[model samples]
Target: MKAVLFGIFLLAAGNASASCDLVSAPCSTDSSGNTYIREQNLGGGYNTYRNGDLYSQTHQQLNGTYRETYSSGGYRTYYSDPNRGATYQGDPKGMAGR
Candidate 1:
């Protein structure tokens, strides 16, 4: 009886830990043959998603700008200017005049 209880506890704990891990895959299938997915960080950060042919993502930065590129085609970019406490967004461009 004690061994069974211990096994059950371990299984529950494992499940809880697994929930905090990052997941990357199709979450569901719709009637029109569309799929949805969510990508997240296990720790503490941003989450992103890709649905059908469209892709979108976001990130949490500690000090500077955060940038990411998608496999579909285009890219998403963001930045926080520490001196002015402002944020900027646009396509992936070179930082020369800033």
Candidate 2:
């Protein structure tokens, strides 16, 4: 498991820091924290862990490639090369039934 600070820095909530793993990866994940986006802004991405569950998604251009992660777990990743492009369309995954 890797520790990654994702999304806009909402300040440190004491000890509830951000991390990256199988449940919370960097991609098109969503959150219950009002605003949601997976393009990994504010660095790369952020994952919220609680009750043995995870929620997050983020993407950013790294090394000339677009790195993306969906709520489809954290271990996997989809990267768009320098000239390639990709898209993900659907409701938020894992956290909500929608």
Candidate 3:
């Protein structure tokens, strides 16, 4: 029982470390040493920058839906309800999934 509990704790810790809460932190660094920064727009929404370049822009609608547009031309829409979200792939300029 003790070993099982320890394993569960370890798994949770690993997951927590791997995930980033963008609202709490202005920036986050991945394991690959790439840094992502979140800058709030004056009008609304936010722009995310990766390695000093535009990565994506997220805008929230009045209905609370989130639309994220990537610099690579890909875009995703997140709905408040589960399974209602949509993602569209765009040209990555020869890069796989960016």
C-alpha lDDT of all candidate models, in order: 0.43, 0.37, 0.60
Pick by TM-score: 1 or 3, better one: 3
Best by lDDT: 3
Candidate 3 displacement at residue 10 in angstroms: 40
lDDT of 3 by residue, 1-98 (tens): 99999999998876554445423646666657656666778967778777668888878778888777778897776664212222211221112333
CA deviation > 4 Å runs, candidate 2:
1-40, 44-54, 61-73, 81-86, 94-98
Runs with alpha carbons beyond 4 Å of true place in candidate 1: 1-39, 43-47, 52-63, 81-98
State residue 49's C-alpha deviation in candidate 1, in Å.
Answer: 2.1
TM-score of each: 0.28, 0.25, 0.53
Can you write out model 1's per-residue Cα lDDT over 28-65, one digit (the tens) per residue?
33345434344456753333343434344445566556
RMSD of 3: 10.8
Ranking by TM-score: 3, 1, 2
Among all candidates shown, the one with the greatest TM-score: 3
Output the better candidate (2/3) by lDDT: 3
Cand. 3 TM to true fold? 0.53
Report RMSD (Å) for each prediction in the order shown.
11.7, 12.8, 10.8
